[model samples]
Target: MKALVTVMPKAGVLDPQGKAIGHALSSLGFAGVADVRAGKVIELELAETDPAKAKAAAEEMARKLLANTVIESFRVEVV
Candidate 1:
């Protein structure tokens, strides 16, 4: 099985990197941009064959180490 993990900062958290990217986009002539959020994607290959198991394992991994639970949120997609 293949899993994709997306980690992003929770709402209300200050995102300096996202702000910088938004500013740069406006400066580069992409106008009307209101906000931007930066996040990371992780791809994983697992031996589990069931989609449910793969998703559960990936979510556990995110909770344990992949994401900082206090300030960040994670979504897992099993493929």
Candidate 2:
């Protein structure tokens, strides 16, 4: 099975990296672009064959180690 985990900053969190990217984009003439939020995706290979089990495992990993629950949220997908 394969699992994909996406981690992103929650709404209302200060995202300096995202801000910098937005600024850079505007400087590069990409105008009217706003509210750019940055995030990451992680792919994992697992032995579990069931999609439900794989997803559950990935979600647990996100809650325990992949994301900071106070500032970020994560989504898990199994394939």
Q: What is the lDDT of residue 33 in candidate 2?
A: 92
On residues 2-76, what C-alpha lDDT tens digit does candidate 2 reach at each position? 999999999999999999999999989998896799989999999999899889999999999999999999999
Please give each candidate's TM-score.
0.97, 0.95
Flag regions of model 2 displaced more than 4 Å: none
Per-candidate local distance difference test:
0.96, 0.93
User: How would you encode candidate 1's per-residue C-alpha lDDT over 1-79 as one tens digit per residue?
Assistant: 9999999999999999999999999999999999999999999999999999999999999999999989999999998
Could you tally the backbone clashes for each prediction?
0, 0
The alpha-carbon lDDT assigned to residue 5 of candidate 2 equals: 97
Error of 2 at 14 (Å): 0.3
- Candidate with top TM-score is 1
Q: For model 2, which pairs clash? A: none
